[model samples]
Target: MIDMDRKLGRWRLRVWGLVINLVANAIALFGIVAVVEGGSPALLIIGATLTVVCVAALAIPPRSDS
Candidate 1:
């Protein structure tokens, strides 16, 4: 039972991570479009930074108390 619970938790974490990464990628794409259209580069910087952070976070697995 405990193992099943752990598996479920990990699955939930992966889904959330995937969702966050998708949003970050969308932001980065928007930033790229803005830059190409002559908009400020700040959005690109923000999006890239966020994307990097998210990727880094996704690399780390959740710690188990057991």
Candidate 2:
């Protein structure tokens, strides 16, 4: 029973992490588009850099065991 609970908790954490990453990625994409529409190369570059950082951060798994 305890093992099952632990597994469920891990699954929940993974799902939540995925959801957060997805939202962050979508926002970053939209930011890039907005920057392009506004005709600012600087903003576009910054947005793209931030998006890459955000996605990289999301891709990295936590160190501590659940």
Candidate 3:
């Protein structure tokens, strides 16, 4: 039973990490395009901030068993 829960928790973390990676990549691409098009610096800053958050999230491990 505990093993099953641990497996499920690991799966959840993997999925969340994938999502964060996707979002971070998309935001980075958009920021690059925006910069080329003379868009606001604020957008680029926000994208960078989000990327940092994603990286941090990926670095953190999931919670242990209750």
* Reference-based TM-score of each model: 0.65, 0.45, 0.59
Model 1 per-residue lDDT at 35: 95
Give the per-residue lDDT of model 2 (tens digit) for 1-66: 122112354474445545666665666677678776885556455556666655555565554553
Off by over 4 Å in 3: 1-11, 61-66
User: All candidates' lDDT scores?
Assistant: 0.71, 0.56, 0.67
Candidate 1: residue pairs that collide? none
TM-score of 3: 0.59
Compose the digit string of candidate 1's lDDT tens values, residues 1-66: 122223445476556666777888888889999999999888788878888976776676655752
Name the weakest run of 10 consecutive residues (lDDT summed) in model 3: 1-10
Poorly placed runs, candidate 1 (over 4 Å)? 1-11, 62-66
* lDDT tens digits, residue span 1-66, model 3: 112223345476556666777887787788889899998666677778888876766666655653
Top candidate on lDDT is: 1
TM-score of 1: 0.65
Give the top-scoring candidate (TM-score).
1
Better of 2 and 3 by lDDT: 3
Shift in Å, residue 21, candidate 3: 2.6
